[model samples]
Target: MSASSPTVPETDPVASGRPFGAVDVTWLALLGLTLLTWIVGDDAALGLGRSALLLMGLATLKAVLIAAVFMELARRGRMLLLGLGAYLVVLWLVLWLILARG
Candidate 1:
């Protein structure tokens, strides 16, 4: 009610309705990733190191999907977006180093 404070409209784009198909697709992708992780469990075909790498990569991909679509973090916040990018890079690098070591 303060004159100085800015008020956001109820029709903000973020709050607007989204096409239902997009949500369906995101849900399917999440389910597929879950099945993939389960399928990769205790498999010797790729060996231990490579399997670990593959699993970690899938995990990162899943995280990105959830963050971007489910959490809707992709809509705004530049610094937060940059943080997600940095997180993915640092995560892979750490995994790569560990693989190299062991």
Candidate 2:
């Protein structure tokens, strides 16, 4: 017997007017955020303490996005994603406090 080919839906976003899907959008966002972080790190004159905190905050955001989107944890493992996101936020806060105190 001949195998039937899988049919593509006519309403698919790629097939329609939209070029980017959720993953593509997420990737672009990550790229932009990375560029912003690089710029902030290179030219942020907000003092060492503030700069460190800002960089850490940006890093935490990137980490959460990567884990949620690229890792597919957001869809498949809500609890795990939440836990990781919470942990990242807490770590960022704790580090910022420590750096600020010093």
Put down candidate 1 lDDT per residue, 1-102, tens digits, no spaces: 689864553444445655454457888998999899888966768776777787888888888777776766765455676689679867976886688567
Model 2, 1-102: lDDT tens per residue? Answer: 347854545654546667666678888999999999988989857877888789999999999988987887876688999999999999999999888877
TM-scores for the candidates: 0.69, 0.75
Give the candidate number with the greatest TM-score: 2
Residue 98's lDDT in candidate 2: 88
Residue 63 of model 1 has an lDDT of 83
Lowest summed lDDT across 10 adjacent residues in model 2 is found at 5-14
Model 2, stretches more than 4 Å misplaced?
1-19
Poorly placed runs, candidate 1 (over 4 Å): 1-21
Which whole-number lDDT from 0 to 100 does residue 101 have in model 2?
79
